[model samples]
Target: MFAPQSDRVALRFGDRSLTHASLAACAGSLARELTGLPRVAVWATPSLETCVAVVAALLAGVPAVPLNPKVGERELAHIVADSAPATVLAAPGVDLPAGLDSVPRRDVTLDGDDPGSFADPGDEAPALIVYTSGTTGSPKGVVLPRRALTSTLDAVAEAWQWTADDVLVHALPLFHVHGLILGVLGPLRRGGTLHHLGKFSTAGVVEALEGDGTMMFGVPTMYHRIAEEVGTTPALAAALGKARLLVSGSAALPVRDHERIATATGQRVVERYGMTETLMNTSVRADGDRRPGAVGVPLPGVEVRLVDDAGSVLDGAGPIGEIQVRGPNLFTEYLNRPDATAEAFAGGWFRTGDVGTRDADGYYRIVGRKATDIIKSGGYKIGAGEIENALLEHPGVREVAVTGEPDDDLGERIVAWVVAAGDAPPSSEELADHVARLLTPHKRPRVVRFVEALPRNDMGKVMKRALRT
Candidate 1:
């Protein structure tokens, strides 16, 4: 069995490297002091220290809720109120919420007694509470058991063939599952070294991968930017090609971005399908074909299917419907909302609330969310993802968000929020024309609004509701 890292480098940010033993010691110290509390809230930056805190909580058998350090007072208060954490551990220099006791992560010192107090948790005990996007309503926490994570880490390690010889250049934030489970836990479980980047700059990531780094994890937005940067320069693209696997998730990976990455750097991005609830369920196989739009077959022990509105299982890939998942990694329940938890499951499968179709080979192709983000216009259902993917193909478009704006004639009109890239920024008319040339008439954006940047939540997902506001 794999034990926690002891001698190898656990985290690397900027110029610093923290060894596994040191990271364990740091977490052990925090765990020792917090033995009285059942839960602790981790409000911190995406750093090596935050990674250590997570491990400490897990090994110490105290569930840790990693809060997005960027949220405002009201949002923080909501999370603190909902989770009811006994203590909040804030990164150094971050302000703490009212009525919450604070501990500066740096000030947490580890000694002999700290490590000695550690206890293994029951496999069925709740380990984490990652909240949903709350796009449709108030965000509810999804409770994951220790066994859920332990199983997920095992599946990912086996599927990816992770090893100490591998190096993961991770750019995603630790607050989310993609960064935490796929980036940190799975890698550490295999004794693989992690080169964690505090902030992503195309140059910085390129520099890190130039070393022994073998893999990378990023959100669609980050990969889009990296692809764009590489498109502008050839040598940089060549350097990026050195990494073996470039994985993306948290949102749909645009086919254009995938093609650009491969064309520029000769590295095919292995886009995976996963969420905060179930960790990683599907991935583009490293040794097999990297299909453009397909998030490859379900991982070991995961059962994926598409069902009609009536909750009846559908036949071979035809019409898209709700995607349901059943696996050992599935969340036990939504933290406090019993109704929502019950409603989320139909029969034995967890209703993903995501619309997708599975191909003959069982690879899943996500169409859009079942909720409001999906746009219906002129008797045709349009996916915001489809239009957004089209907008990303435009050379002058840096970032884009698509939303369904209510229309008088059409049920909903597609409006795009774009971050302009070039000297002659593409006007809404020009972008509309550009999209018109590539997509069906219905898929084109009716209006395009240029913006400094799209609003994103702590998990790096573009807050579509915020864009509409």
Candidate 2:
């Protein structure tokens, strides 16, 4: 796939860069080592070695489990026991935690000639066994096939008007779907260039965009930082002004940051929606309206519908329903969990477990996860997303998370845990009125608690389960 860009730069990290030919040769060399392995675990740090390790496993047609370096020993042990990888691949001389000690290790050394022993695997073959970051229980291994990767990547390219001529830029972790699949493999598949910041920094992003970078992929937190900087940094504003597309995913980008960045750079960050089980189902098209909070329509060949809890597809707006999708983008199954695999699908559509609403124009807006973010107060179903977005607009609010606390009168009351901006904090009444005014009076947070920060996972998603009363 990257043959056309053989001599062109394909991957760049801190103080290191690799051409397409070099990447292919390196992965091919590692493939020779990976061949015939039942499965392999990659110590997936955000580095060139991690990328090369995954690529090498792909080349050798072995299913890989990308292990997050930050994950706890217990979880890591669970993954090791579940996946039962024959070997763990890591960067040279890096000491792996004791959790992975039982598994044999292989250094992902980038050398050796292209042995030409690897062949393209069938689409039915398992490609990756990614673990979910759910709050309820131990992480489940989502088994993804090659076709899911290809279909989603192709669909995104079509939606974004992406081409080999374009250069993609991002500074995200390699362990997740957003960064690894779209950030790394997408560029390789399209024969495009990728510039990794190694770690997200506004200055680094500006420097890349000032160079040959045409597109950027970021999370909400990254865009928030960029928005905070763009107003003061003329170089950043100018660099972003010249970029072709700015995409945000993994979580919802706040509307305030969206408008702030747009006002400064005239670039509306496009948002997309997907999960580990479903690679990608919907995205905002590059040629279409850059709606602030909307994730736009479904991607090509992917069918999405808003269905109420009763299992009937919804028609109009205002009624929040679970997002169900049917497409080739779905994972094959949950590893060794046939019950979960069966429970994930209803008829032909996969229950995404995400609550959302669709307008008459077919634009989709994510509410939140049904298990957590959907709050029932005063016999009304309210999404914490809209309320949180509204609260984020308040000048004194830096970060906010909305949850439903058990109430005697209303069954459940809205609660807001906020990280106040600066030293002076806004009164609970003021913040409540802010949300009430922006949305409806009922959506106002019934109770508010000020905090230093909300607990978050590696991907920057707030862990509501950890918030204290």
Candidate 3:
């Protein structure tokens, strides 16, 4: 919930700006029109219209489903049919694909007057229905309640020391939780200002931070690009050093890149852990130690535990196990999938499907996802994240993804898909020896393949599933 602010600027996109009063007036007008709809769809583009549409839906107490603009025809059709939105909202002049033609279209306009006042939607009310990436099958619509959004935002606000005075800057997409909920709604919930770059660029980051921007949120891919150029670009480093906080999420920020950014800019990028189902679970605190590879402790009111395969809760930090979480920040259910909703929970906790270890201090270091990131070779169950981090430390290695392949002898063998740093890349044997020396002999990649680039999704996370295929 946003507190009343005067005519202060609330959102900025490129040269366009929206004051708190103006945004409320525009969204409130649309909210009046969106009222009584079963559900609505927002063409989640990185623009102010998309922001207005989502906020309007929330104001109207109508569940809003965010559709990725880059979604394929098949996935788009599936989402449209599943959510069955009453109308699709988009910016004027934006061309929506044919998949969305089944629903009527409404263009969001900025010139409307506020619709007096509205009643509070109960905490249990569905605020959003966001679809997952569907790594295994068709993407499932995650139903996020009003309480989940409020609770997660409040928890993170406490963790990050975020307040209305903070001017947030980021270029993350608007479809997923990290970008849409955190990047966009997080600021609004705090009654703070947001400066969204229509597209991410080093120059834009420097300009925003050098001016009024106090915090910046980015994924690993964006930070990696910053790390590569920070050494050569003094302005980039200087601008980053001036920021109050720099956060990275959606995937692990390689320790190598973390160190480079820290060394050059004298700032450690904070990492947080969460998914589509759970808005946020853990985050590195602003007032605490800035650990390079740790995602930090669980947020306030959120419970996290490590569980072994036998469904036993593991204690302490030595052993890596599945991360189970119970929190108010969790989504209510998978839309129309009661079977999935029932299976996702273990007893009372939501199974995150992520494997990690928690130290005695309560800090969490994510190993990787259990489905794609855990590698079983010989008698050891290795996490691909650690191996990827090790490989990234090499001077000749630019970007890398580690996966496991079927092997009759070892059950599964570690394989490295690397993007080289230079023309003369390190040989497979040399790289294998490098990893062996850094980690364990068995942890070394038994098979190495050189590639120009690792396949990545919109969030900059390496699509390991694509590599396996």
Q: How far is candidate 2 from the true structure (C-alpha RMSD, Å)?
A: 10.6
Question: RMSD of model 1, in Å?
Answer: 10.5
lDDT string for model 1 (1-469, tens) is 1356478886787787777677666777776776767788776567766776677777767778888655434345556778888766655566554435433233333332344445566888888887654444345688888888878878766666667778899776677677777778776777778888788778878778887788888776677677777898765686678887888776666777789888888788887787767777887677757888888878889888888888888879767888888999899888888898898887868887788988877778888777756665533445576567667878999999888876643546789999989867887887887666554465578888888988999999899888787
Candidate 3: lDDT of 439?
Answer: 54
Q: Write the per-residue lDDT of candidate 3 for residues 270-368, one digit (tens) a residue.
A: 999988789899999999888988999999999999999999999877789999999899999999999999999999899988999988898999886
- As for model 3, its CA RMSD to the true structure in angstroms is 10.8
Q: Which ten residues in a row have the lowest lDDT in candidate 1?
A: 104-113
Model 2's lDDT to the true fold? 0.85
- Tens digits of lDDT, candidate 2, 376-427: 5543446677678778889999999988876543446799999999889999
Of candidate 3, the 10-residue stretch with the lowest lDDT total is 374-383
Model 3 segments more than 4 A misplaced: 373-469
Candidates' TM-scores? Answer: 0.78, 0.80, 0.81
The best-first sequence of candidates by TM-score reads 3, 2, 1
State residue 109's C-alpha deviation in candidate 2, in Å. Answer: 1.6
Please list the C-alpha lDDT of all candidates, in the order they appear. Answer: 0.73, 0.85, 0.88
